[model samples]
Structure formats: C-alpha cells, structure tokens
Target chain A: MADAVSTPQEIETELRKVLSYLTGNADLIHADANKPFKELGIDSMMAIEIMAALEKELKIQLQERDLAKFTSIKETVETLLTYVR
Target chain B: MQALKLNKHEILKHVPHRPPFLFIDRVVDLRPGKSIQALFYLDPAADYFQGHFPNHHVMPGSLMLEALAQATCVLFDITYPSKRKRRFYAGSVKARFLKVVQPGCELELNSKVISMVSKGGVYDVWASINGMDVLRGEMGCMCVYE
Candidate 1:
C-alpha cells in the first residue's frame, strides 16, 4: 500500500521514475512536469505502458476513463493521488 | 467463466473480415469481456507465399499481429454487445516474435483484456502452433462509433 500521507510531490517523483524508465529519458526527472506527454515524446501506446506500470508499482487499479487523462506528470500525479491509499 | 465455442458461420456474424484477409477460422473458447481463443489455418497455397520467400515461404510477422488484432476485435464485440455497431481500431502494439510460423500450420490465437473503458481497452494477445508459443504482445484498441 502507498503511504497514506504521500504528497503530490512524492507522487510526481515516483511518476518521473516510471516515465524515465519507459521512455528511456533520464532527463524526465528535470523536464517540465506540466509538459504534455506527446511533447515529451510519449505516444498513446507508451501511455498504456505507463498506466500498466503504475498499476503494478502502486498496487492500484486505474479505471479506463483514466487512460485519456494521462496528459502530463502533474496531472497524472493528481489523478493517482485519488486512487492511492 | 464457462467457455463458449463458435463455428465459422457464427464467427462470420461477429467478425467482418473475409477470405484472404480474414485470419481467424473459428473461435474455440470465449469468455466475454475477459478472454478468447481462436484458430487460423495457414494454407500453403496462399498468394503471399509466392514472393514472401519463393521456395522458403513463411507467414509474415505483421499478419500474425493482424490475426491477434482480429481476435481481439471479436473479444471486444462479445464483451460489449451494446457497442456491436462500433468498429475496433487497433491503436498501439508491443509484440515479441518467438518463433517463425510456416504454411500448413494451425495457429491458436488467444487474447485477454487487461483494462477496458466504455470506448476502448488494452489487451494481452498471443498465438501458438501445436502448443508452442510463436508470438505474444500487448495491444491498445478503440471502438470507433463512426
């Protein structure tokens, strides 16, 4: 289970790790968190990969509607916060 | 869930593909909204064999993916009956080809939904020959209402 007190910053950090691994772009840690995934070189397929990876790492289930909501890291972190216990 | 089988005639009603382009011949097992197992016969005289390799003919890898995609479409149709009118559009796919598929082989296609929403979903799909794994991958698809 994720830490109940996990802050958005913490979630963002974890998300950066996942994105870096999936895209093989280590600089994502420093990249603008608000940048859209498309501008960051992530496509729809990669988005699905990210979602699947997050589900496994966080031990959470994301709904289908959440797939289209993966616009940016900041936005994704906020969405994840709602699901994380 | 209990497995439901569909013959070629029944499969035609659910799948829109036709001869030459149609990869699946019959569905052996189906669990709506979850998973499906189908089969395809790789005929030796298929037109692609004439140039695919000349004397050493082999089924193209892309077609294998198409077969998997078609199976996924069938699963989606059965899973969401209300969305039967919608067309399935394959979005993105990540696949690994483990073995070469040859002519006259019976391809066992299988697909399982990993995640689904009202409009689309992601699926895990694979195909095998004589129980030997040939290809496996993850595919994303959308149901186009148009």
Candidate 2:
C-alpha cells in the first residue's frame, strides 16, 4: 500500500514503469515527463488501463473523474499523491 | 442487493447477440454495475468446431473472450436500463488461457467491474470448467451510443 511517506519521486518512478510497460516505450523514464499522453501515443483505452494498473499497484481507489488526470506522468503522480497522502 | 438471474431467453433481451454468434447461454447471477456470473454450453456440433479441428475439437480462446465480453454487456445493460439500445464494444482485452476447453464443456463465466470510465468501464473476467480455471483476464468495454 502506498503510504503518506511515499515521495513524489517514488511515485513518478512507478508511473514511468507503468507507462513504459504499457506503451512499449523504454525511454519513457528519461523523456519529458510533462509530455501529454496523447503526444506519447497513449489513447483513451490505454488511459483506462493505466488507471486500473495504478489502482492495483498502489492499493488505492480512483474514481472515473480521475481518468483525465492521466494526461501526463507528472499529473498522474500528483493525482496518485492526493490519495496516498 | 438481491441477486438477479436470467435464463437463456431472458438473456437475449439484455444483449443484441443472436444464435451462432451469441456466446452466453444463461446469466446465473448479476449485480448491476458491479459484477456478473454467466454460463455457456459449448456444443460439440457448433459450426466453429468443424473447422477449428476435425479430430480433436477445442473451444476457440477468442470465443471464450467473446463470451466474457457478452456477459459484461448484459451486466451493463441491466445497470443502465435506459442505455439498452446502445451497443457494447470491447476496446481492449488482456487474457491468459490456462486450460484447454473442449466441446461439451460448461463454461462458467464471471466478470466484475473494476472501474467506470468516461465511455465505459474496465472489468476483471475469468472462466472455468467444473471449477477449474480456464481463462483469466481484464478487458475494457465502451458503450457506444448510436
């Protein structure tokens, strides 16, 4: 479970791992984290998948409205932090 | 939260699928917007078995996935009765075939809504024969309003 002590960098690393695995882009961790997922070739379906994966990994629950926050790596980490914190 | 059960005939009303293409035979349990449990009988004489294999017939894995998807559609229709007219399309699926399903096997299909999205939702689906796991996976479904 992701606790309050979890840092932004840790969350970012996990998010990058998920993005790289889902998008098959190995350079995701080193690329611009602020790039929009659409620009990174992530579609609506993939967005849904990322949310599902994160919820399972972090042992947290995210609502439908949070789907939009998955636009970029940084945004996703922030959204996840709100729950963990 | 009472368990809703639907027979073969009643199942048709909730989904647009018909014979041949229809994979679900009956819905054993359903919780609108939450989860669903259905069944399908793999008839040995089914057309697909003829070409799928002549000597040894095995239920196509894709059809099993389709059955799970159809079950999700039924759950969706019941959850939102007003959207019954809409079409349910499965956008993405990640599945693992654990066992070989042969003809005459009674497929027990189960799916649970993982989360609701803008267009549809994500679901965790699995199937078993005689309590033995055959397939397990997650899929995304979109309710396309026509």
Candidate 3:
C-alpha cells in the first residue's frame, strides 16, 4: 500500500498540484490557500475532479462526508493529514 | 450491446426512481448476476437540463452514475430475486466523465458485477454514445433491508 499523507507540507504540495490543474495556473499564483474554493474558482465539479485525481495518485479512498467538510485548501490539507496513511 | 429490448415500464418494476429522476430508458441485454447493457435517451425536455447549464446543456456526471446504479439494481434483481425488495444504497463511487453528454444524445450504459457481499455488491460501469466512452468507473452499494 502507498504511504498516507504524513505532513502538512506534503499535503500542500499535493493539493497545489491538483488545484493548479483544476483552476489553471493563471489563477494559482493569486489563490489564497485559506480562502474558500469558490473564491479560487473551484466549482463543485472541479472539486470532485480534484478528489478523484488525488485518490488515484495517493491510492486512498475518501468518504463522501469528508468531501463535504473540506471547502478550502487549508481545511482540505488538514483533513487529509488526519487520514493520511 | 444489442438493440432496444426492455422498456422503462419493465425497469420501473425493479428500481424506485420515477419520471424526471429515472435516467434509464431501456435494457439492451442483461445476464443475471453477470452484466447488463442499458440505454438512456437524454430528452431535452427533462427538468435537469433546464438548469444544469442554461447555455451549454450537459447531463450531470453524478446522475449518469445514478443511472448506472439503477442498472446495477436491475442486474441484482434478476440475479437474486428474493432480495428484490432490499433498497440498495450507493456506498461509494470512483468515476470519471471523459465526454460531455448533451441533450438528444442516446447514452449506452453497461455494467458488470465484480463482487458481491452478503447484502451488497460492486459494479464496474461504463457509459458511451456512438461507441465513444463518456464515463467509466467502479461503484459499490449496500442493501438496506426494510
């Protein structure tokens, strides 16, 4: 099995990769990690896409409830760290 | 996938979803406990299209998955008739929508039962239009006995 996300830095890097791809690089530089995803132009569809991509790359399956709880990059990384295996 | 066969009336006997919500239109071919090929004719008149996108209308990916789930339920119904009344709740889904399905497109959906638990099952599902894959994924559902 693959190692789970163990550190905040690791989680942020992973999130950045996903967010960059979903929101496009033009907006990535201006994105505030603490702001809600909506402010960063990440819609529900993009959020789902990011989750799918992360699940595949991380080899981890996240629950639907977990998806509902993380609305910002900071919250997402924090939540991911809690479940990082 | 074969031509048209089982109609919505027949499918309704198995699944609980109704008009405007039921995404399945017909069952092309099905092998009990094995696999199923179904169809959904995306009607522009459907309510979802009215708001899904005002300008560029496209069927929701989540609903497409629901269509697959309904088809899986039909397979389970034929495979395990005794458990027909059990409500199968989608437990998890790992899906990717490769193409945007628009109104008036006929969706060809196919699914195969990959695993079965005492009260649930997992299905490998794919959806296509004109022989091009639009979506594919793995979905699991658990049975809730009433």
Candidate 4:
C-alpha cells in the first residue's frame, strides 16, 4: 500500500507530481494551494489526466462527478484525505 | 467463442462514427464480452494535426481515449449482436498517455471488459504503435437507444 497521506500538506506534495506531468511545466504549478486548477490553466482534459494519475499513483478512485467539485488544490487535498488518511 | 477478425468496411456495421470522427480502422481480433484488438492508421493529413500542434503535431490524449472507447463499442456490439441498436457514450475515462503519437503512425488498440451492468460497463484499454505502449487505462460508459 502507498503511504497514508494524513495531512493536507502531504497531499499537496504528492499532487505536484501529477500536475507537473499534466502541464509539462513544473514551474507553472507553484501557485497558491487555494487557487483553482482552472485558474492555474488546467482545462477539462488536464483535469481528467490529474484524476487518472491520482487513481494510478495513489490508488484512490475518485468519482468522475466529484472532480469538478474539488476545483482547488486545497479542496482536492481535503477530499483525498477522506480516502487515504 | 474464438477471436474474430473484421475489415474496415465491416467495422462501419458495428460502429456509427463516420470519417474524420471515426478513429478505428480495422478489427484484428475480438472475443465478445472479453477483449478486442483493432488498428487505426493516423493519417498525416488529418485536420486535427494542423491545429493540435502545427509544429510538434502531437496527438491529443483525449482523442486517444476516444479511440479506446470506440473500440469498446465494437466489442459491445460483437458481444451482443442483438444489442447493436444501442448507442454507447463514453461516461468515464482513466488513462495515461505514456508516449507521443505522431501523424502517419499506425496504432494498435486493445480493450478488455472488466464488468458490465444493465446499461453500463467498464473496460480496460491500451494502445501501441510498433509494439510500444502509448496509452493505457480504464474506461466506462452507459448505453441508450438512438
């Protein structure tokens, strides 16, 4: 099993890898955690890529509908905590 | 039943997607309710190539998923020929694009059904060009009559 991410900070650290891979620019993902992914220039397709990476790397199966609900890194981290924590 | 082969024209009978939008080219092998293998020759003259990336010309990952989903539709129809009347739409997709597909490439697509409910089903799919993994993951969808 993957290491449990008990805190929001840990989730952010892990998610950075996914974002970096999706956008193909590690520097561009340095925005505030509270900033929405759309605001970070993540389109619908990129969002799906992130979701798939999360499921594959973290083994968390997030419902497709719930992806839109967690628009920001903070929101996503919190939701992911419920599964991995 | 054993795997069956289908040519391009026969592919049209199983899927409704037409030219420009249709991503699959030929069915190499298929075992209804189990798995499928198909081919798609990515034409360099495709319109999307001009816009997706004029210089780099990378095939969009979303379209790759669509190709996989379309192959699953073929599998669904072959599995239950009577249900060919149903229209299937891509509901969920979870895939990873491991390689960049350029124009003039011949993609070999493979799909396997993981589960199926009343009107919904799940499939694990993958694609390759010359024996290299390009994309792979799971897809799900529900069907309705047109």
Candidate 5:
C-alpha cells in the first residue's frame, strides 16, 4: 500500500487548490473547495472542462478507467495523490 | 414538462459556464461512455459574428473547437470530476465542414468516445442538422497534472 496519509485534511488541501483553479478556468461553472461539484451542479460537459483544466494545471496523467474512481471531489483528490507521489 | 427537453438553465447545473462563451445550450442524453447529443442555436447577434464575416456571417472554426472543448469539459464535470479532473483536455482536434451553420439554424453535436489513453482520450464527433452531417472531426485530449 502507499504511504498512509495522516488525515483527509491533506487530501482536501490539494483539492481546494484544484477546485479553486477549476472555478477560474472553466467558464461553465463555479465552485469552492468545500462545495462538492455534484451539489454545486456539474454535468458531463462541465465535468470535462474541470477535468481538462485540472490535467493541464496538475500535470498528471489520469485517463482510461482512471476517471471511473475520481467521479467526485473527494475521490479526485485521493486519486490525484496516488499518481503524484 | 416534456420528458425530452433541457434548457440552458438545466444545462448550467452540469456545466461550469456563463454567458457569451458557453456553446452547448442543452444536452439531450449522456449514455456513459458511448455518445453525447448537444444543442446549440445559431445567433446572428453572437459576439464573434460581427468579426467572423461582417457581410456574411458564419461560425468560425475556432469557436467550434472551443465548443467541443467546452462541451467535453462539461461532460467530465458531470461524469468524473475528482479523478478525471486530473486527466482531461484535447490533445488534437480536426474538423471538416460540408455546409454553413447559418443564423437561426439549430445545431446538434454528436460525439462518441473512440479511444482512451493513460494521459488523455479521443472522441469522434459529428455536427449535424436535419439528419445531415455539416461538420465532422476527431478530438483528442489528455489530463496532465501532479
């Protein structure tokens, strides 16, 4: 297993920055770190926008079935950490 | 309340876009990894129209590119955020036009995922109206982050 993360807080910190960036780059939607995209209202197109921005901004390769797990903010952040380290 | 109707307002819930830039007005359906049908109305008063063809208006190819990008972005927003967020964007896009997207013409964009990679994905998209292929292209995108 990967190094155990101390808490979900570490994951949220990374997510907050990513989500904030998503809100800026994507012209289709608005969201904060605390706000889950599903709650803030995100569909496939919007999801695709944020995903593109995140890929550009984060510099990570998350393609194919990798997308299946990162369907939500919490899951995305967790997944991001997986490839990052 | 017709069963097969979606307005811009409803679309907003799924996409992260505001006015002037957002292209796809509504999505008729999203069948997971298969295809997507989106609606857009050709407006003579659109911001880009003034410059694209002062005398004869035509939707520029760049806007179509952005539309594809925007629509795909919105798709990821609803389908996979936290994971794909770190992995979504167009690496390549090629389009061909058989006819013009004139004012008042209702446009429909139909796209299907062709292949997915470790870094990005490719989609085969066809833009049509009245069951005619007006524009067609293959879009390739990726997610690069750390």
Candidate 6:
C-alpha cells in the first residue's frame, strides 16, 4: 500500500508527478510538491482537466464517490490513491 | 492497418436502425478487451432534440444513456454472431452532467467494460469533445442472450 501522505516530502513528490501529467507541461514536474496547487495557482477547471487526464492515463475511472466533493491536486490525489488500491 | 472501424454501412448489420432514426455515426475504434470509441453528429432537427428542451435543444440524458447502451450492444454484436445476440437493458446508471451539449457538438462517446457476471455487465462511458469529457457515468445492464 502507498504509505499515507505522512511527509511533506512524499506529498510533494506525488503532487509533482500528478501535476506534470495533468498540465501537459512535462516541465512542471520539478515544482515543489509542498507548494499548494493554490500557490501554483491551479483553478478548478484546470484541476478537472487534470483529473480527466489522470482518469485516462491511470485506467482508473473516478466516479462520483471518487471526487471527494473537493477540488485540489493534493485532495484529489489522496482520494485517488485511497480508491486505487 | 486499423484493427476496428465500424462504419455506417456496417452499423446496419449490427443495429436495427436507419437514416434519421440512427443516432450514432460510427464506432471508430475498439479493443476487444471491451473498450470503444464512438461518434455522433447531432442534428438540431432530430426528433428527440426537438422537445427535450424546447429552447435549449440539449441532447436528452436518456439518449446519451442510450448511446452508451448501443455502444455496448455493438461490442456484443462484434463478439457474438447474430444467432447468439442477446437482449440487454439498463440496470442502473450513476451519471453526472458537467456541461451543456449544444445542437452541433460532434460528440465522441467512449466506454470500457469494467465488470461482468454470467448475465450482466457494467460499462464506464463518457461523453467528450475530441477527447475532453463532457458527461460521464457507469451503466449497468443485463446481457441476456436469446
């Protein structure tokens, strides 16, 4: 099981990987994961776009239950990792 | 070199439909593993759209749901000959509408079979623009072969 996002370092690493795939800006992978999506300035629409990309790439369908009723990279990633296993 | 392309002409053999009545244009790609990409060119004059939303002219959610079923039916058609083609009906759908689909939106509907029992299956179908999802849901149906 993926260890819970217990450390800022672990959270950042996963966030950076997800952001790179979602933004289509492969270069964005270098951003600090601790830098909140808000700090990086990701809007809800962009987050949804990224979620869609993640849905396709991961081959894991994110359902209504999977959305977590919140919008943000970290929250979404946590939700995804929770359901993925 | 394309492995799967179900054109309008071939669609007739697989579906009991005709011009004006047929809502789907083509099944562009299919991975026998139960994944499909389909196309539908909307016409404002389509009978269903006429009354679905008097002024807004949106594609009915029910029809969008039908497209998902039809896509799944075609998958069965491709895998099973007419002799064994079964009857399938909607069991349940956890659907969500994210955007308004206009009269001219060339929608691409894609789905993948997620789970199956001996007589039924579940499909994850999403409505999209090019590859951008517009509406999404999972449809459960009973695959009953007569």
Best by lDDT: 2
Model 4: docking quality category: incorrect
Docking band of candidate 6: incorrect
For residues A2-32, could you state the per-residue lDDT of candidate 1 as single tens digits? 4543677778888898899878899998889
Task: Name the regions of candidate 3 deviating beyond 4 angstroms.
Answer: A1-85, B1-5
Preferred candidate (lDDT higher): 2 or 5: 2
lDDT of 6 by residue, A36-80 (tens): 666675644344444444454455566634433434545655766
Q: What is the C-alpha lDDT profile of model 2 across B1-146, one tens digit per residue? A: 99899999999888899998999989999998799999999999999999889988989999999999999988888887764357778888889999999998799999998976546788999999988889999998877677
lDDT tens digits by residue: candidate 3, B1-146: 33335788888887878886888989989887678999999999888998999988999998999999888888777666664356777766789889989999899989887654335566789999999999999876666677
> Which has the better TM-score: candidate 1, or candidate 5?
1
- Best candidate (score: TM-score): 2
lDDT of 3: 0.77
Tell me the deviation in Å of residue A66 in model 6. 28
DockQ of each: 0.39, 0.57, 0.03, 0.05, 0.06, 0.02
Better of 2 and 3 by TM-score: 2
Cα lDDT tens digits, model 6, B31-103, are 6647788899887878878788887798877777787777776665665555665666665677898777878
What's the lDDT for residue A76 in model 4? 81
For model 6, state the Cα shift of residue B27 in Å. Answer: 0.9
Q: Per-residue lDDT tens digits of candidate 5, residues A1-85? A: 1234334565455455555554453522234544556665553444554455455545555664656665666677676677666
Per-residue accuracy of model 3 over A1-85 as CA lDDT, tens digit each:
2356568887777778778865666566446889998887775545555665667656677665666656998898877876774
TM-scores of the candidates are 0.84, 0.88, 0.61, 0.62, 0.56, 0.58
- Which sections of candidate 2 miss by over 4 Å? A1-5, B80-85
Segments of candidate 4 deviating more than 4 angstroms = A1-85
lDDT of 6: 0.65
lDDT of 4 by residue, B22-50 (tens): 99989999998789999999888899999
Segments of candidate 6 deviating more than 4 angstroms: A1-85, B17-21
Candidate 2 DockQ, CA atoms: 0.57
